[model samples]
Target chain A: MPSSKKAKSVRAATLSDVGREAGVSAMAASAVLNGARTSSRISPETRERIEEAALRLQYRPNAAARALANRRMDTIGVATVFESRELNPYFLEVFNGILETAALHEQNTTVFDWQRGAAKLPGWCDGRIDGLILIAPTLTSEAAKVLPGHTPFVAIHANVELPNVVNIETDEERGAYEVVRFLISQGHKRILHVSGVAGLVGSDRRLRGYKRALASAHIGLDNALIIPAGFCSDDGYRAMRSWLQQHAGELLPHAVFCVSDGVATGCLEALSEVGLRVPDDISVAGFDDTLSARTTLPQLTTVRQPLRAMGNRAVEVLLDRIHRQNTGDKQLTEKSIVFPVALVTRASVGAPPAIKRVVPSRR
Target chain B: MPSSKKAKSVRAATLSDVGREAGVSAMAASAVLNGARTSSRISPETRERIEEAALRLQYRPNAAARALANRRMDTIGVATVFESRELNPYFLEVFNGILETAALHEQNTTVFDWQRGAAKLPGWCDGRIDGLILIAPTLTSEAAKVLPGHTPFVAIHANVELPNVVNIETDEERGAYEVVRFLISQGHKRILHVSGVAGLVGSDRRLRGYKRALASAHIGLDNALIIPAGFCSDDGYRAMRSWLQQHAGELLPHAVFCVSDGVATGCLEALSEVGLRVPDDISVAGFDDTLSARTTLPQLTTVRQPLRAMGNRAVEVLLDRIHRQNTGDKQLTEKSIVFPVALVTRASVGAPPAIKRVVPSRR
Candidate 1:
């Protein structure tokens, strides 16, 4: 998209240019134009003249000079793995909060999207950012050990315990428990649980909560009802569709509880394809009341994690740590910060029907 | 959350430390450990030993040093207004593409979120980023004039043309025309248009397209059916709901054409609240095939703007401009790059009902 003609040789206007145009010293011009802390002493008339000159000259404050003087880049780094081409709604919601808070603080946010085995994480700790926030990092203990001590870090849903990083997490087990209990209270005897990856801590916690809730009501755990699925919508769709195909003509579960809103969305689509309607033929619920939950026609009955609030809180805590480190104060030693979750009752869930429905064969 | 205890004084190991541990010169260590371009001649034995020594010392490459050595940060800046706390799906889709391309180029993406009238955009031009991408910037001519000449910039959906900056956009008029024409073909004579802000270029273009499509089909334009709304779902919901309230007992439009998918989703909710079934009662369509379109049941029939492709192209063009600037070559003179749009027919739209239904009053 470049032109063949050469660009003009004129350089951008500098502080000196503004000063010359304003008939003042560069220091006086800088004070008034760049909003330097030392500008309080400048007269109002002089300040007005400097501003006019700056506008006429189109002067821009040099960020490098400011950074060098303040010894701060005023930037925060977000490190995460972009596992797929599609944008993840979970990341979108959390990032919206991060951006909101970072904007309030007038800080820049740099995203570092790393692949699973790149292990290039250590190189990012240099002076580019004041601090780093890790999103659902699956780092091993050994990998975490090599993190640079110079930079402060905050982790959200960290899989392993880092030495000193303060991890922010939600009570997924409790969220799962409440939602499943609510379904059971609606007279749902047979419930299908589309769990996340079998071994992940978050998935396992939700499974425990589901079992605990069922046991409380004296309902035995049906091994056949528990199915393994990954986190995304495609996983939910394939898992549910295949299960329905295999159990064609068999008694269907009264309700299905998904590990994530995305999974629930897929389940809805799969159910629609199989001529079954949500909450009418079979009640369906999901976890994590993300935008997908509300986007659905019969909105999902799910657990609401305070994701945005936690994101805002992470920035505040990270900024505090950055300030402490700059002042040579002791670093944060807290192990983790936990946020509460609530049950969101929406249109997706309903009581079981008087007559049991059997799975119809897929056309 | 900082602890009161004094912190340990140990610093991160550097390349020099790894070199010393490996009994090699710093240059040799740089070649082996940092993957310097000059490292091709290094023997396998030396490379393995250097790697092991680097691992033993836990040495990580310093990004700041590399940036300083190359005199380029290898980072791109994305500036936008985060008007609301919620992440705009438009931003999300475009950003997904930006992130993908940026990752491919091994470049960092730093987001600068500014409030309206903040006007601190110039301060971001200093050395940290190679170039800049402005997302849907609405700069007045005066504001556009103040942009720094030294930094190369590419704008996506820019409202006003900036000097020497390439703007990336889509043919909204055509997209709108095609979708409206499709509705007319489906036997929808009385169609309501929920448009964006009246004066905005995008909104006006869509309006023109709707009129043109109607003219082509020999249908008279109905001023009463052209309602004003903002881009978000709340605006759509409020506008449609209020219209329904006012038009109670009046003949309903055979279909509603919304400006964006968010608005369409809101329209769906509003219609449902009034007990109107989609397609059965009235057909609905939206523009911008964002994720929200698919998330909704009976997914939206909308216009597809290649937002991700546009985002990826912006980065590529920006990178090119950055390179040309570095080489002191010619500057870009192109005013705008326009991408084509297509109609995506999904479940939300269908043939108009045989009978003209009246707007039902709320229960």
Candidate 2:
């Protein structure tokens, strides 16, 4: 039979061709060449011979051909909403970690916009990716079932638990409590908590943490102080601005804790607009020490979630599941992986002002 | 022969199956079902028959299978450096636009981390993506030659001109001149320009514009006022801080013009650290009206580059080139497309301070 090398057009070297060159069985070449789990049993000398043969043949791994063999595409899909307002500093930090780890493992990362919701997820699973990682997914249990069961999946900050999918999350409620507790320790009274959207777990969890901290400190929860704002800088600005406009002559809170860094950034802008100085007239704190946390003037005092580490672990867990499924050992014992959060004290927070200043009527 | 419906497992319907169901040749089905360029010549009745057959069979286009027919992957690879430091706000705005346009055209967008540079680009072109988009690539002309000639490419803010690739760029020099001229119009004679890296085209062009504006205004350029700094926020902060420390008690410039929004953000922090206030003590301006521009306390007065529009156009042009290349028409008449730049006047800039303030010693 004619060798593939002598074909009319030059073609990529196959496992069979590598085996033919190395004087071994096609299975032996597959183990060493594709890094299959069985490759460990192959002798070091044989592995070296296969590797040398592949190099001499200039063999490049064909993504398509490998999919035919093990049905593994060696690509991971990242699903997130990519709207203008939603693409916050949090996504950038997490994605940086995802791309870093994926590259380290010689895997490709492709992103899918989940704007159309969970219904469109199964369609994206049609052979393009080995697994998918949903970022801060807000899907119901019923909606989560739309994800195909055959593919391994992972979620970071997922609002709901999906069967068989590992969820990587931070101790956000604890983080909020710790930060607020720190604010209380700084002698702050009448603290204002600018909450996120009412229904979201991300929002409510922080709100819960705020109430718990206030109760532990023996301070009554001021229902008026808990302003329900949406996420993003614009939302925070609008919420704070409207509140200030309504109570122009009322005493300002000693400190304000915003739900996210983006919100905190907006609050700072609004405060600055109203001629209030951060940490001097009133201290400010934020959760999720994202880029926005550090970029603002006087830098925000925020809760540090190890977002990059979480992203790296998500890829590692998903890859382990993929490999286990490939080897016919597919049980995932750990359904939840939570990382601890810490307080990042920056220039944003300070001792409460000596005098309670009234909210000025104009800038 | 039995129809495909009798198959044991449900399979995606192919053009041949559609043809059989519609009682027509496979070529007719290819034209109608595949929507090939030739499909326009088919009669309305035949198209309707093919559509009905496809609906009955539940035909869905398989990405891999379609690539086999047209040698087109229907996917575009976006090559950029994804790192904690490199993942600037500039990329987020540009990427949003790319995703939006790609979704509209039904094209899949996959990201390739180009941290390894041009050496890894050819390896990525192995039958996976139809074309590639380079975002803010700093490839040398020699390095650009390594790109595979067969694949189409579109570049946004590419540092060097490639032989056949279409390059999308903004007029940074003009933006710089207009902004500096505006600063002069605001009664600022002594202006400090904190620039990006010295060798980069982006840096040099803006420098040239600054000098041109100074010369046109008959104001002699002060070599001491042009401080060389990198682009990121930290670079800007350190540069400004070091300069202020070295020039303690010296007369401060009436205005500070930063090379990018990130740099301006840092300058704001450094200025705030001292006793200086924006537009009151020293008017500050920035280039590249990115998210950092708006997120600042006093919104930045900078240049608008239309980054999203550039990203959208990059996908469009690359797709056009890919289709033309598939049809054997690969002439690229235009090598570079320059987008106009505009100045955004905001609260950052104001008239020069009434009296020159000395650089304060410390925070």
Candidate 3:
């Protein structure tokens, strides 16, 4: 029955069809339907007839035609890399904000998977989208040089300084510093830092903050205490498990500061496997209070980077640039928009235990 | 410095520039560059020269131009609803699959926020996208009749049978039945079912499964134990919290079967607040083994719907429809694609506690 009904339906009504029904020229119909500047010249009665005809036909303007006339597609492109075939929770949070703001502006959001480099970026500027947003792009200086100038771009946590591209970021170093200092204040002297991938701007900033916090507390930094773990939970789990295996029977760190909530989740799993109780044996803290933070049993005491707000701002800044380009305005816009980060205290973190705990052999 | 470099960059090379460099006509360059049927007429030497010239100029074809020439945009549209300003993990899992497959096919994925209706769908088929994918669309019969005939559509978890559209779905009722049976086998006699929205198909199927399982065991259904909760975590939390408050002195259910992982998370929070440990005090199970399942301290025991594979299939089916429509091929596609669901046993579910547990007062 549904198929029969669909079979009876015809193609969408065009401007010419509406014009014919209203007994007017297609040009006059276009002017009235699209609210063109010449619409005022049409008679009020004729305008009413055109509107009625359009309503009856359920006429909706074609996006391609509208885009051709205005030279604007009204679509924003988002480019990001997926690690291990999974889109992290951080992307979901930011994309939620982007979707909210984009819907408010009546713009469509298209996503493209940027495998590794920015080399394919130029090919994307072929006029299908008016602007693009690069989410945490790690671009080489050479790849950055070849970026097309016609399409506007906005980068969130860009690894390098892109010429004319506005970068939206959080005060990551300060957030790391505050959380580490909080850990130190709780009498955690031997603190281990499970860090992110080396050479990334975010990773480097968080590492610097960790070192600075220890130095300020007059606590010596132990090279053995720093573990190289990537951002994902699997990476954190493997890193923590290996670290424990290598340091078996040695005194465990008083607290652990993980680079991300995902990493902290892995660390928790590793600790639980070794029959160690969190906060009872050692305190654990994570960065980026993503959804994963609250999902954990004791809930992660992590730093909030305001990722959603940053996503919302990326759209606003990109739109501003698009507007300026369209209007031939050359006024400079803000190059960097930095958001503040906060420390969220949760059950995962507590004062160091009175008795120093040693790493136990894996079961 | 980036701005200075950007200012010095020239506009992208056009087809004419490549032709001029190759010492050939623009038509010849177009044939070779685009690999048109006419390319075979040109000599291999000339084609090689044109290719070299193209590489030298770094020329890329304009998408708009190509689309205009081929009557295809090479873009697919995805429409879905966002609940409480958050894109649930369910969407993320499906979207990841979509992104992966879409990349392999070199198609762009544009997302549109469809705020609860099929009425706005017809307006989206404006020649900008080749096809559209509707994610769990709740459509009225009246609205379904007016779906645009020109655009190809594939729905994942569509509530009703859409005429001429392929609907991809999972065996939810079976999944729910198996999980409940598993709980019953663990000696959980009194089970509480936290259901999704009452009228929705997924909710109804899950509810039916619970009743069928109980009936098979000759256990009478307790309407009082069936809490009317929506799909989200907040809904589960609120429903569980209120149910416990209203029956402070009553014996707790042996196990709770939630509609989703998000709801199970909320249930866990509520139980924890009441000083009841999961599996130890009362077992909890959920449907939809989303990312939230593993994030919990004791991961959830739930049903796996293969949402990612469903998403990938939606794209494939939609693309097939688009190709068929474009080539004037009238072969009918499968109206419904039902995928099998499986039970994923984790740490959440366990045997009933040795003694009957009473609901405690809220702290």
Candidate 4:
């Protein structure tokens, strides 16, 4: 072997090679090594020969063929909606967990982009994968109905009701309320909230929590302060930057509650450009303790949604349901597993200065 | 229907239902709608009845049947080593692109957990997925040889050379050398390097570039300044922090060249903890302009690896190779494609401070 090719081209041996070495039929070798059901009645001597031959040949069963015979692909499909946006870190965390657990069960994990639409999903949800995992799906009720009935499905943070699907959701309402309450405890009043898209279940839940927190504290809801910002960090930056430009000379709120860590990261950028020090001039708290939170200058004070844990748990539940759905004749179980959220205190939130009754506007 | 029952009972009508409702055999219905290759030779009247019956019965061919008959799972596998470390934003970028393109091709992508020995890979390659995409694989040479030859593999940043595999790698050497040269132009003679794992191709290539840049600038290499670090952000933080503590009061290098953006973020955190401002105190440059680069307060001056494009291209190349591999008796092609890296100038770099003379030790 040449030096350049020395370490690179190592091809694995196949079953036919084992069969030939074993002096048995390919089916006999397949039965012993690759688990072909039809070849189960092979002689003991032949089986031993096949096994020994497989060892000598270093035969590895082909993945595609195993799937063909078993009807169990041993692969989980993750259906998500991350596209042009660079906010994939959030999805990546959840996906990492899914991969971790899926691998443990000897399953391969696949991701499906639901950002396109439910129109194209029926084809994807077929015999190819054993089960499908939906992440933050915003499927229309009509389109959701088109999902294949034979396959099992698990959804994370689904916006609408998906029939026969086990929805894994975080308590976003409580998470929002907790962060807002923490901000209030720090002597902050008149807080500004940059929210996610309206009509989105997550956005509504967080907004409701914000309102509930305000009511509990006997603080009046400031309609002008609640703005619908999108999910991306860029959205947070633009939303905050625009607000600052419009409210240039106005009294700033003591704290700004961002909907997600991506938003918080963006808001920090906007603040930096305008020279507003986090927690010093104005406090910032974000929902969802994603990777973005810790990367920021003053690491964000945010609510921790167990995204990875949820992803891992979703795989376990989905796998269980898939086996039951396939082997146990369409057995349906109770739907929805809701996980609690935690408030993660970090450098972004602190006590409001005594002299500054109102926070300074970045503009 | 009550919500509980609604959630539990979503049985999909199958092709058998369509056959029964259309007053024909299941094979006849399959011949009409499932698009099986028994020939597109169904009677026009029977086809119309099958279509009508399918609509009335809401019948869809079982995905498993389609997969078994076609041997086209429409699923691809994505293997990565993300589970071992904290979620890095770098993987997110490439994964997003993979998801987007896979969706466009109507291909479902499965993620394979890469922590298992390469022995585990052959099990996955057996038949579950049509093809495999290896994301940043660090496979041992022995294990690499065990990868199944039947399944086509496309590797992104393959640490070791793989035979019969098309490895997609960024030109980190050029990027590293250019970045260091840029730093050298800023009057920084003693630039410290926080390297990745000692044996990784990326680590050695970056070290070579750093040395090449120093040589080009006529600066003597200081072995003490080059610290051993690894890929993760935490490694960078720990490496730089330990260096800072050990060299307390000594004059800092004009610039610190970090392994990747994740490492750079950790470096920033370590510097911040010590009350040292970036660029003003010492400049830092990162490789692999991942999302963390932009997320950081002082956006990283780094090298962009075109991860998203590489991911998209991987899909194209993998699909192409899969097609060629499946085209009759020809073997899979053994061609390799290398992508170039570009310098990304953000806010992290600045001119070296004039006051280089100092000796202050921490007491």
How well does chain A score by TM in each candidate?
Answer: 0.88, 0.88, 0.93, 0.88
Top candidate by DockQ: 3
> What is the fraction of true interface contacts found in candidate 4?
0.65
Over the stretch B46-93, how does candidate 1's per-residue lDDT look in tens digits? 888888998897776655566656657788998887555345778877
lDDT of 3 at A208: 88
> lDDT of each prediction vs. the true structure?
0.84, 0.85, 0.85, 0.81
Q: What alpha-carbon RMSD in Å does predicted model 1 have with respect to the real structure?
A: 4.9
lDDT by residue for model 2 (A288-338), tens? 987778778789999999988988999999999988766666688799999
lDDT of candidate 1 at residue A145, scale 0 to 100: 89
TM-score attained by model 3: 0.91
Docking band of candidate 3 = acceptable
Better of 2 and 3 by DockQ: 3
In candidate 1, chain A reaches a TM of 0.88
On the 0 to 100 scale, the lDDT of residue B143 in model 2 is 94
Deviating ranges (above 4 Å) for candidate 1? A1-72, A83-85, A104-106, A140-142, A324-332, B1-71, B83-86, B327-330
Our tally of clashes for model 3 stands at 1
Off by over 4 Å in 2: A1-59, A84-86, A327-330, B1-61, B84-86
Interface residue Cα RMSD of candidate 1 after superposition: 4.0
Rank order (by TM-score, best first): 3, 2, 4, 1
Local lDDT at B322 for model 3: 88
